[model samples]
Target: MASHLDLEEQEQLEQVKAFWKRWGNLITWVLTAALAAYAGWQGWNWYQRDQAAKAGAMYDEFQRAATAQDADKAAAAAGDLKARYPGTGYAAQAGLEVARLQLDKGKADEARQSLAWVAEQGSEPAYRDLARLRLAGLQLDAKAYDDAAKTLDAVKSPEFAGLVADRRGDALLLQGKHDAAKAEYQKALAAIDKTQDYRRIVEAKLATLGVPTVVEAAPNAGAVQ
Candidate 1:
């Protein structure tokens, strides 16, 4: 009986060895690939953390320069951020901040360059959209009506849709397209939230174009609580 049991165990051991001989390479390869992938993912997580830390430091430096009203230092810091961290959100923010500073100091062309960088290179859609909006405003101020209209056309963020339409209307109006401007203003009025003060601006724009807007009345505060 012991001899028979030993024979059965030997046969099972042979079966397992045969199975390993057939599939060992495949199993080994699969495990190797999975381990490599996990390592790569971990490496990527570390790289991203390092990048964010460095970018945050640069952004803080830019903010400090800006706060001290040091235009040259702020511009330098912004340039460095743009050059080194264009892939990071801090670059877009620094671009916008420096652009604002430049504008306040009457450096319209420099501000335009900064805003254009944010509009074209920002990783975030919202940042690009905001940059485009401000850039279009600068174009409008310069009386580049066609350019302003074209710039506004590039703003596709849903949150800024109404504002874009309003700007488009202003551009068209400046270009003497009164009917088209009025239509754009109407779209702005339709899309803007009633509670927002910006909606009132759009309403006024529509009113100027002879389009009457029916204002929504405020609910009675004491009706229910």
Candidate 2:
């Protein structure tokens, strides 16, 4: 009986060895690949966290410089953040600050460049829209008529519809298209909340074009509550 049991155990062990021989390399390779992928995923997470932390600190510095009205310092810090962390949201925000400061400093061309980059390449859609709006306004002021219209045309926010129309009206007025301007002004009025006090400004714009006020001083026309 002992010899028989020994023979059975030997056979089982040989069978196990044969299975390993057939599948060992494949199993080992699969395990290696899985472990490597997990390590890579963990490394990627750590890298992103580190980048965000650094970018956030730099952005705080940029904000402080902006608050102090140190335009040059703000621009320089923001530029550094943007160059080093262009993939971060903070970088896009810094671009906005730098653009505004440049504009305030009468650096129109530089402002346009910064604003255009933010508008076209910002990481967030909302920030991109805001940049486009501001850029459109600047271009309008510079009489870059076609460019302003094109930028404004790209804005698709429902909330910005009224403002865009109002700006378009301004652009048209500058181009001596009073009739078209009036139409756009009317659209702006229609887009705005009738109860918003700002609607009065739109009304005034329409009045300037000799269009009969459709929403005079109705108490409800400018009340929110």
Candidate 3:
């Protein structure tokens, strides 16, 4: 009976060895892949956090220079931020600030370069729209009517539709396209928010073109929270 029991134990050990031989390599590979993926995920999180922290520090330096009204310092800091951390929101904001400073210092060409960069490369649509609007305004002031029109045409955000139409009207008016300008102003009036003070400015613009002003209706009480 003991010998029979020993033979059965030996048979069970052999079965276990056979199962390991068939499946052990696949199990090891699966566990290795899972561990590598986990490590990669952790590394990605660490990298993002490090980038944000560095960008934040750079932004602080830019803000200090801007507040001091030091155009050269601000421009340098902004250039650094944009170069090192173009993906960060701070970089786009820095570009806007740098452009404003350059403009204030009568560096029109430099200002245009900064604004063009933001318009072309800003991560946020809103920032790009703002840059385009400002850039078009500069072009208009310089009497580059065709360029201003082209810049305004590039603005595609619905939120900026009214402003773009208004700007387009201004460009057309400068080019002596009175009828087209009037039509654009009408479109601007239709699209502008009724509550904005700027809407009244659009109304005044229409009046200058001999178009009757449309009064905005007051909001219904039921529509108020």
lDDT of 3: 0.93
Model 2 spans with C-alpha error above 4 angstroms: 1-33, 156-159, 193-200, 212-225
| Deviation from native of the Cα of residue 56 in model 2, angstroms | 1.4
Score every model by TM-score.
0.89, 0.77, 0.82
Q: Whose lDDT is higher: candidate 2's or candidate 3's?
A: 3
Worst-scoring 10-residue span by lDDT in model 2: 214-223
Tens digit per residue, CA lDDT, model 2, 105-188: 888888888889888778888788889989998999899999999999888778888988999999999999999999999899
lDDT of model 2 at position 16: 94
lDDT of 3 by residue, 115-170 (tens): 99899989799999999999999999899998988898889899999999999999
Of candidate 1, the 10-residue stretch with the lowest lDDT total is: 215-224
**Backbone N/Cα/C clashes per model:** 0, 0, 0
Model 1 gets an lDDT of 0.91
Predicted structure 1, TM vs. truth: 0.89
| lDDT for position 149 in model 3 | 84
How do the residues 165-184 of candidate 1 rate in per-residue lDDT, one tens digit apiece?
A: 88998888888899999999
TM-score of 3: 0.82
The Cα RMSD in angstroms, rounded to one decimal, for candidate 2 relative to the true structure is: 4.7
Highest TM-score, which number?
Answer: 1
Measured on C-alpha atoms, candidate 2 has an lDDT of 0.89
